[model samples]
Target: MASNNRQNSKMTDDGANVTSTPSHDTRQASSSIHVNNLSYDATEEQLYSSFCVCGDIKSVRIITDRLTGNSRGFAFVEFKNTTAVSDAIKLDGMRINGRPVKITVAQPRNSINDNRVVQNREEYQRNTPSRTRVVHCKKSQYDVYIGRPEYWGNPFVIGKDGDRSDVIRKYRAWIMKKPEMLERAKTELRGKVLACWCKPEACHGDVLAEIADND
Candidate 1:
């Protein structure tokens, strides 16, 4: 059995050290619980079934090795309600398949990059001439920017000169593999016009527009 339980700690906005959460998650600490000292053979399904008895569960993610894809003897479970988090924490220090488990509220990850963004914006503002102006727009309302296909300007497009068919095929395949990107794109493009930097006939932006229109 793998005896070592892998743990990760990160700094939060409040200047406190805490367990790291997923980068894309925006849930509060009360909604997530960390479980450690898990049996090496413990499965996510088993963890779900065990925790679901306390309340509704949203997700169960067992941390694993990036190289070997083996369990790392710890996991993070998110519940649908704060009450469920409280209930789940009650099981801390309890035996699971003969191994005692450690449970606690998962800590929020810090947004250090936000500070850098602010600093860069300030520097740009200070250096800019009065003749230049900046326009701020919501991300969804902003125009899409695609570069020349030969110059690799459009990351979503593949192949030389960026064939439209190839772009669409590649994009569809990419979204299929990354369902989160598809979901986010669907959400961001809602009620917005889709326009790309390149000509409509030459760019793959039409493929994305088609997706948004269908939605």
Candidate 2:
């Protein structure tokens, strides 16, 4: 929240002393906002233009697959202040490219780092042979659901069979359509030590944590 110091003035060639206002450091004032359920074809320009109506954007970063280089159906928009953050929050449940995008303030980088440590620990605990295995449902984008589908275990089959990518895409689309389901998942998962397969970068588990903790 700290800003750059404003400097006192100096006399110019015109013999007038001017006091320069402190410049807003978008980086220092910057806060990240998460945007999910983006259309695969959504462009950075479109995102920038939409959010800029609320505040000056520091940057727009869209997450993409490492190998395929395709949009992961999400992005992080950085804004200059809490006011902009509030403005952007109004965009949540609003349509973007014919689909409603889920918007929330991203967790602090340090908190996310701390989560990695906890996630890894929980992941290890869940994988232990002694613990009872829970159902594996790929129903939501967050991987929270009741029934385990057969495709999940054997996602890579031949001829006409769908792969993991297909499953993820379908799940993302499904959850985006029914955000109530996501809220339900967050409510159910709150306060429990759940495993997070995705770490370091943002993940659905983190989203659930953010929602639950805030509530």
Each prediction's TM-score against the native? 0.39, 0.41
- Which stretches of candidate 1 lie above 4 Å from their native place? 1-29, 111-215
TM-score of 1: 0.39
User: Which residue pairs of candidate 2 clash?
Assistant: none
Candidate 2, residue 80: the lDDT equals: 72
* Residues 12-57, model 1: lDDT tens digits: 9999999653445566557889999999788888889889988999
Per-candidate local distance difference test: 0.65, 0.62
Candidate 1 displacement at residue 172 in angstroms: 31
lDDT of 2 by residue, 12-131 (tens): 999999878766754333377999999888888989988999898989999985433568799999887667988898889887777889999885566667999999978975675422
